[model samples]
Target: MSVLPLVFTSGWASGINAYAVVLLLGVFGATGLTDEVPASLQRTDVLIVAAVLFLCEAVADKIPYVDTVWDTAHTVIRPVAGGVVGALLAGQSGSLSDITAGVVGGSTALASHFVKAGTRMAVNTSPEPFSNIVLSTAEDLGVAGIVTFAVFHPTAAAIIAAVLLATGLAVLVFLWSRIRRFLRRRAQRREEKRLADGGRIPGRAGPPPW
Candidate 1:
């Protein structure tokens, strides 16, 4: 079977939760459920580490600002993970060039990551914490479902992932205004907090230069 579908699916999942993607793929590989997964992903140490990080992300992703912070931190990590996984998958399957797979996976992941980040920013504008938890839970379930399904039905999973990616991007675009407003408000709050903590405005400070 062509591994392109699985690569795309995994990349989409990784944008939301790289650790979960790694853990799921690793488990699937280790349990003899699929041979398309690379052996490197199935190592005991790899699974354990992925499990630990997945738990951390699961917790961090349910909190409001914490989730945004976590997303910011993973901005690079997720895309990199997607590329590496794609390269590995291609290498294992020998159906596609590793570089081509890596680029496709990384680009897909980057686009999805932007959608996730923008949507979260818009969501965080809400005062309630429950939305964050609900959204985070939904994302986790979605990633798990799509990834597991990919192991059995790669082409179908890829199509589903593509639809989801399109939907997410559309939603992000719809919420772009709200996301921008939220960012402005957040920056204002941060600046206010910094000033409150004795941070002075450049060239307009009252404190002595001592």
Candidate 2:
């Protein structure tokens, strides 16, 4: 969907160009600092795209004001774009089709933006001005690339666009597992300490005092 639109607006050539930039940054930008996604996906092109998007987000997010600002700007742009594209492409598909397209597109775009925004909060450990500006500029270029290429060369662009969508899902799954483990450990410790201190339930004690 994203690649299709990007190709539509940018010219097919622009779409491919956009896809390449995202792939380069996403696949090789960083390793574990963000998420540990493979450079390429198995079957889905979106996985590769998500990897790049995630990587681009990871890099942009590390900056203080940069990531926040970029997300804010895109919130309005990404969704409307999604809606417009959906409406146009779903010709004769009726209102439901447009609505469905809008919903899916908007959701995907918002999630991608959210991950990018959230990462910056943790990455602001380095207060370097140059790095911040560089990252922000790169992201700006990424958006432009997608927008430009959406019209000219959709097939190539579509393949590139698919990479990021899948990567985001992988990143979320990885984060969720880590969080679940942490919570479980924390709960077990609390339970152990409570039992050691005889903090058992007054009425539900073992054997019921029989």
Candidate 3:
């Protein structure tokens, strides 16, 4: 029972939604639903704090600009949480050094975090808010499902996480240029719209009436 699979899976999930992973693991550990989970993670204080943060994230993550801001703020927090959780998982097995697990978790989380943040930024270029809400909800669900599965089937979950991470990165790379162009076009459109509406563009005077 190498904890590597759980470490990777949890790290990936944490990048997307660390609080949810914490809340789910804590709840499962507290209820004796999962023996692999660490006791400290099951503490009442940990659960409460995770729940509160999760709630806040749930709301903030559905707002376009706000979600980006929230993501920026959490650029460090999520990876650290991933490392901590990974270490805790390793501690349960006592077969691996906590430092090793922490490195794996932190590195995996950082990769996934960049993917998530970049995708969210691209999605935010759209003016509609529903896409943000939908994407956020999907991420929350994905984290919950993967973490739950990881508890009982770590190897399978790890495989799945790896596939997903690779696929997402590939897609992002393939579309990177297109995404940048699209965002630029959207910005230009917005600027034009504002000028047409007699709003001044930064560094430019108001447009003359047609």
Which candidate leads in TM-score?
A: 1
* Clash statistics: count for each candidate: 0, 33, 0
For model 1 the local lDDT of residue 197 reads 57
Q: lDDT of each structure? A: 0.93, 0.46, 0.90
Number of clashes found in candidate 1: 0
Cα lDDT for residue 77, candidate 1:
97
Clash pairs for candidate 1: none
Worst 10 residues of 1 by lDDT: 201-210
lDDT of 1 by residue, 88-203 (tens): 99999999999999998898898889888889999999999999999999999999999999999999999999999999999998999999999999999998988785766577
TM-score to true structure, per model: 0.95, 0.43, 0.85
- Tens digits of per-residue lDDT for model 3 on 1-210? 699999999999988999999999999999999887899999999999999999999999999879877988999999999999999989998867899999999889988988888788788877899999999999999999999999899999999999999988887787687568656876898889877778654667656545
Give stretches of model 1 more than 4 Å off: 200-206
Give the per-residue lDDT digits (tens) of candidate 2, residues 1-210: 332343233222112122333343233223332221123322257446645665665565546656555556556655554444444334322433556555545555555555444433333334565655665565556655654344345455555556654564567565665445544655798899887857656667653343
